[model samples]
Target: MLDPISILNLIDDVMYFPILIIVMAIAGLYFTFKTRGVQIRLFGESLRILLEPPDKEGAVSSLQAMLVSTASRVGTGNIIGVSTAICLGGPGACFWMWLMCIIGASSAFIESTLAQIYKQKDHKGHAYGGPAYYIEHGLSKPKLAVLFCIFLILTYAVGFNMLCSFNLQSTFIDYSFYNPTTTPVIIGAILAILTGYCLLGGGKRIIKITSTVVPFMGISYVIIALIVIIFNIYYVPSMFELILKDAFDFTSIFGGLAGSCMVYGIKRGLFSNEAGVGSAPNASASANVSHPAKQGLVQTLSVYIDTLLLCTATALMCLSTGIPITPAVSGAPYVQNAIGSVFGPIGPIFITVAMVLFAFTTLIGNLYYVDNALIFLNGKTKPSEKFMRIFHVCCAFIVFIGATISMDAAWAMADITMGGMTLINLPVCMLLGKIAIDCLKDYEKQRKMGQEPVFKAESIGFEKGELDFWD
Candidate 1:
């Protein structure tokens, strides 16, 4: 029988590797033009919303919604992913990443906006909406909706969700300098306790945790990278030129460039911010906002935080340090080593703490995603309680995998699974673009008129009919 790896490789080599990038890129480009560059118009507004008070009708506050998404976005992927991309694809990958982010931002807004515009509520008065519901209810295609949800439930629960734990457990075991089997078991124990805390508390608690940890960890890493950049400020100009030269040189069939780093960087960038992937919509839909467009704006802004702010910092830190990482280093730990090459002993300690914060919060945040997917697929989910519990246990097991599994395998699995999530989400966004734009115009109208930005769901004038879930 073929192994699981073979199956994954076959699907990836033949199918996912191509359409995933093309469709996502096209979607991003299309949205950029369609929104009249809304990503640019509302860029500052996205940040401004964080400071303002939330509208109180939604399940969570605006800041909390961003945090929940950030919790998942700012993981080992930000640092290690960036570093790996730079090492293989070279510094030029960073620029390509920024390009992708700029375009992808609008797509992020469109998908997330639709999620809010077509939300479906539970009997408990809490809101539940994402690509799954949007595809089903907005597009009026239950089969396609179920397919999306099934892929998401599997990707979030089995592929991505557990991987976060594995990264955490394994990171700590190495930091603790422990033995082989003991490390994973001990790490699993710690992860189990923490996972239980957030999983039991629900999305509210998960968002609450993210609001505290995500910024702290992300900003902290940026500060650390800043120090490295400062010491190498003199080379900054030459570095930029080098980056530009390598990126455009073109790799392989494209050109003379090595292409390894270029491919890795773009792939890792996508893996990091997850814009246009539809997963963040699950988190964004819970926010009580003045408008659906407002939530979508913030969702797009998060790609900047994940890719431009956090991931770019990792790239600068590694590139400036002159580390011997021209060949990819795996995840956050490689970043730790690169920093340590410059900062000495404190480097590992700093990264260890950052990774713990990054991976732990990711676990909590992604588990909540798993929970949302479960609740979405199985309405009245009490019957799936046992399965949910089993899912939780498997989550702990996956954490062990991240902790001990090969980085190549881990990275490949994440990118492939994330591609899976994006495939389900991007199609719905394109099909429902008109609804998203209508929501954006309504939001702008309310804000422009000096109103408090509260409009009834029906008044937004999207294509969808029912939006009582958010009421």
Candidate 2:
């Protein structure tokens, strides 16, 4: 019998490489052509629209939704995950991640737009939708929707946040001299309390918090990275050369582990941006926008920020530092040493602060997905306050336990759960891809007519009464 870790790796192997990559890549390429490269052509509009305020009395602003999902995307994965990829797959991994970010932006747009088009009001009377809603309402398959929701609850609600906590705790243990056992306990308790507080405040609070914190942390980290990169400007050319050379030269990347470079690159990119994995749509659905594509465009920008900017920063910092490749030199240590080499002892401290902020926001963002899932499970009825309280408490307990576990175990658990989610969601997204294409055409038509686009269910061949909210 396979051990638990081995079993998880097997699941990842089965799902991630051939099917997930192909399905997502095709969806992205199809939409990129479908919209004439919306991610590139609409770049300025995305930024301008991002700064616009939310609809009056809307549940979430487009920016807030983007930030909330980005909070989850730009976590320890950007830091530790990048290092792991480069160490295992060589510098070539960065190129694949960039490719995913570029192409995956289209996938992000399609999924998020469909989310908005098919959005329905929850029991609380606020807008909500996701792959589950689209699957149930569009394809008329409630059971499949339930299965997808279960995957989401397992991935984000339970296992994913545990992975974040584990990374944060590892940073604590690695950088500080506190009692290992006591430090994690104390940190876990504090994190649990904080997480419970945020979860109880509801989705509105989650969006607001993420909107504020995500930008601050992201900008600050990027600025620091830019400073370091500037200081080491001479190494930039060599870094690019290494990435380009090793990208196709598999023999140079993996001495005996041949063919694993592409595998690690794609896996890490999927884990980082989550473009076609059907997660961001949940957040996008909550936003109030005149057109579904507006939020779609906003959510698409998040992929660039996650992999292109933040993940790239980590990759360059690690590569430019000329750090030795070894098991011990990977993950958080790799980042710590890279930056520490530039800034001295304070470098590690800087990374620790960034990790805590990024990981904590990720924990909160992960819970927001679960909150939406609970709303889905309730089936037009709002979750009771008592039920939500119990759920929040359970989540806090999970966080505490996660913080106390070994990093390897937490990561394995996250990979297995996330792989299950990708397996379920990518196919569903493909099934619903055409709806998004039609919606984009409709949005563009209205734009050309010098009108702000508004979605009408009838325009999409749905009777007024068939859709829950978009009448």
Best by lDDT: 2
**Per the 3 Å backbone cut-off, how many clashing residue pairs does candidate 2 have?**
0
Summarize candidate 2's per-residue lDDT along 1-471 as a digit string, tens digits. Answer: 987766766666667666667776777787788789999999888897798777667568999889778877888899888888887777888898898789889888888988898898766777888988888988889998888888899888777888788778777655557687798888888888888877777456655665576668778877777777887889899999988988888675445432356667777887889887889999899898887888988988999989988998888877877778666766788888888888888888988888887887888778778877877889755699999889888988898988887755776677667777766666776787777877878888888999878888777677769878776
What is the overall TM-score of model 1 with all chains considered together? Answer: 0.88
TM-score for each of the candidates: 0.88, 0.91
The 10-residue segment with the lowest total lDDT in model 2: 252-261
Error of 2 at 105 (Å): 1.1
RMSD of each: 3.5, 2.9
Off by over 4 Å in 1: 1-10, 13-17, 57-59, 169-214, 251-259, 380-384, 456-465, 469-471
Measured on C-alpha atoms, candidate 2 has an lDDT of 0.80
**After aligning candidate 1 to the native by TM-score, how far in Å is the CA of 91 from where it should be?**
2.2
State residue 225's C-alpha deviation in candidate 2, in Å.
1.0
Q: Tell me model 1's lDDT, rounded to 2 decimals.
A: 0.73
